[model samples]
Target chain A: MLTKRIIPCLDIKDGRTVKGVNFVNIRDAGDPVELGSAYAQQGADELVFLDISATNEERKTFASLVRDIAKHINIPFTVGGGISAVADVAPLLEAGADKVSVNSAAVRNPGLIDELSKAFGAQCIVLAIDARRVDDQWTVHTHGGKKATEKKLFEWAKEGQDRGAGEILFTSMDHDGTKSGFAIDPLARLNAILSIPVIASGGAGNKEHFIGAFKEGKADAALAASIFHFGEVKIPELKSFLKQQAIHIR
Target chain B: MKLAIIKYNAGNIQSVSFALERLGVDFHITDNAEEIKTADKVIFPGVGEASTTMKYLRDRKLDLVIRDLKQPVLGICLGMQLMCTFSEENATECLGIFDESVKLFKPTAQDQKVPHMGWNQLRLKDSWLDPSLEGEFIYFVHSYYVPVNPNTAASTDYIVPFSAAMKRDNFHAVQFHPEKSAEAGERVLKSFLK
Candidate 1:
């Protein structure tokens, strides 16, 4: 059986791992390579690094960081942020990233997903959606949630899948940094609508939240950052907890 | 021992190189027919459309070269599919190292997904690579699979039981990406190296 994946996300700026609350007030976590290696050792099914730095030089730094991480970790890892064109993907894959996630770029031009999935195969393209509840309906937000688009969250997700995105990383802006738990209703809706895997992100305060993500939210994978980065929750401990709940963790 | 990974336009060969790197195995990633022929072992790894990739290989005449390799050779995912007799993917003819046809996976139920992405157990038949991998979970990601046949070294069931691994003569292929499968996967690759 395909197990439910527990992923630790690293938000990197200038090649260093960082975490923030609700996309602001960022703080340093550690070196991305060291942290990623530790997560793989502790049984993180996968790792995701978002290059929050959207500059050319930092992209180079991120590429080298991916190379460094791949040297130490055997499991699959994904890199995202600032990836726009088809040319942006090859260097990262060459540096050993198994998959690449596109958010703002994909939203701006939905065709990029088609182009990417065509060029690199469907398995390598992930569509990361950052959303928040607006007037009782989820709205797609980009630019780290500072900007909101007219696209409805559910419709946009479906379109992304149609464009050949293999997976969806849906992060709830309302639940993010709050630790109040995932926005289960929206997550379950998204999971039900898409045949591909859905990874629930944000608002994982305790072990129970993860259980809720898999059980109530119907997420195929759960991604958390602050809790795992700050050592508030260890991956092994979380896996055992999920395993006890019969979640079939990896 | 020198190992050569047959390079093409396909993506994700880096994972294979990294897997070999972890095992302390040195290798060269080259498409040169002579380089491939001289290697102690050759790994054909790819992630691309079969028809287009086959055209690329045939253009370079690497297709015939791969068919004649005497040393142990491993084909992964798309590489495995291309080594078969033919592929339903774009209706392409392949290297025919193993006389099996690749077909698209048909999910029987509403919830059963195609692509078979994620970890599943391996049921091994006897092979020099390792029978101990039977019942072990390995990672797989593909929309097409090779049906079970005489050359099948191991099998895995998704929507149907299919060839998880294949062996005939000195050519071997696995449908799964052993590099992405953690410890059990590394063990399988280590056995291949041995």
Candidate 2:
């Protein structure tokens, strides 16, 4: 039986983990490798590292960081942010990233998905969409939610799957950082339309929100950042909670 | 013991290599016939279109070399699919290490997805690979699969029950990626090398 996955996302800026993580096992909050290994020890199904660094030197640092994390952590990890072309992917994969998430790049040139999917495979390409509810419809946002595109959330998600994306990481900007809950309605909407797995991202505060994402929103996986980074909700405790609620978790 | 991963035009070899590195096992990723034949254990791994990869192997004459490897061999994902009799992936004939065919998943229900991605449990049968992994959740990311057959060492249910692990004589193949599957997967890989 396929179980719902729980993923903790880390943001990297200037070769360091952005959100300060506080955990007894993890002493270096800035070190991604230490944080990733600690999360894996706590039974995080997978980890996503979004490189928010902009400079060329920091990109090099991110590469080595990815290499180091792959050496230390046993679970799969994804690297995202600033991936623009086919040439950009091999270096990261070689650096030990299991999958690479494409957001603004895919929006700029959708053919990159097909090319990456061809060179690698669909399983290695994750299409990430940052969306915000505009009026009654959800609109796609790019540049880390700075720019909004005409692409509707559901339409872009469908296109993502059709263009050979293995999964869709749907993040709601409205719900992000609020910790109110996930954008459940849109997540369920996206889940209903797409055949591929939908990873619900943004706005996970407590364990109950995770339950809402899995049970009510019908997400294949729920991804959060600060909630996990701050040690508000440990992965094992959340999984146990979900299990008690009869939700299959890994 | 020296272990070698069969290198081809495929993805995910780095992840496998990293897994081995974590286990403190030294390995070589090569396409050379002699190097593969000399290794104590050879892992055939791939993640690409079947027909094109087959063509690449045949062009390099690796197909013949791999068919003759007598040492214990393990194939992961696309490697396992290529080890079968034939694959519906591109209507291509495979290495035929196991007398079975690979076909794309046809989801029984409407919402059931193809490509069957994510963590799934295995109903393991007695095998030398690892008895502990029986009913253990492992990672899988593929669309095509081999059906339940005589070679099946373990079975899993997605839309329908399919072979998650297969074994025949010295050849062992798994439809899942043990390299990416964390703790339980590390145990399975360690057992395979043992």
Candidate 3:
């Protein structure tokens, strides 16, 4: 059986690991390579490295960092942010990153998803959707939750699947870092719509939050930043707790 | 050494070559039988309907060359489907290197997803076929699957049971995308290359 994945996301800025309070007040955690290795040792199933800054220099940093981490870790890592073109993917994958996640760039040229999926194969491409609840519907957000896309969350997720996106990492911006636990209702809606494995992000305050995500939200994986980054929840302890809760863990 | 990716009306050849170039492996994307026959390894990859693909391969005599290769060969996506006896896609007859048929994945009790798309786990069957492939999740995206048989080296669950990876002697194929499969995928590729 494919074990339910436990992923810890690292918001990288200028080639270093950083965690913020509600996507603001960013602070450096440590070197990305070291931090990634630690996560792997702690039995993290996968890692997602988001550049978090939209700039040429930051992208280069992320690309280089992905390569650096890939060389050291024998697990999958996805690099997001400022990835604008097919050309952008080459350097990062070369640097040892297994997959590349596209956000604003993909929304702009939905065809870019096909192009990248075709160029790199479907599994190499990841579509990261930042969603926010708007008027009783979860609407897609772009530019790292800065802009609202007209595309509904599920509609676009199905589109991403059709376009050959390997996985859907859906993050709830309203619940991110809130520790209110995942917005189970919106995530459940997405889980019903997306045939792909959904990585639930945001609003994880406790171990039960993860169990709720896998059970209530039907998420393939649960991702947290502040909880793991701040040492509030140790990964091993959490995994044991989930295992006791009968949620499959590695 | 030159490596040839047998292009039987499939997806990107340049992308595979790009990955090879990064790994410093010399390769080419070719449909020419002579070029494929002479390469160190042959990779057969596909991204479209299998019936149309088999028709093209049969027309070009590529099917014979694929069956006859002695060196390491890799098949991805539909290419993996073609390596089996037949595919459910368009009721197509495929290269019967593996004695299994690709069947459609219908909506089942728990699995309502039509096209099983995403990164899923591979319960690698421990066998001499490929020990390195055991227990890793390879990325997958397919609506149909080759029912688990004696030849299956790995399996996954979607709408129903599906072969995540298959190994038949020198002719190895994976339903999941190894090039896209992250670390577990990297390990699978390393095992295949070994």
- Please tell me which predicted candidate would have the highest TM-score against the true structure: 2
Two-chain complex of model 2, DockQ on C-alpha atoms against the true structure:
0.74
Q: Candidate 1 DockQ category?
A: medium
Better of 2 and 3 by DockQ: 2
Off by over 4 Å in 1: A20-29
DockQ of 3: 0.19
Q: Give the C-alpha miss distance for residue B187 in model 3, angstroms.
A: 7.6
Give per-residue lDDT, candidate 3, residue A106.
Answer: 85
Ranking by TM-score: 2, 1, 3
Count of clashing residue pairs in every prediction? 0, 0, 1
Task: Name the lDDT value of residue A153 in candidate 3.
Answer: 85
lDDT by residue for model 2 (B82-139), tens? 9998999989999998899898998776457767878899888776667877779899
Tens-place lDDT digits, model 1, residues B99-119: 888999887664456667777
Binned by DockQ into CAPRI classes (incorrect, acceptable, medium, high), candidate 3 is incorrect
Tell me the DockQ of each model, to 2 decimals: 0.55, 0.74, 0.19
Full candidate order by DockQ, most accurate first: 2, 1, 3
Which pairs clash inside model 3? Answer: A67-A95
Model 3 chain B worst lDDT run, 10 consecutive residues: B12-21
lDDT of 1 by residue, A4-86 (tens): 88889999988887774232123323677767777777888889998988678877888888888877787888999899999
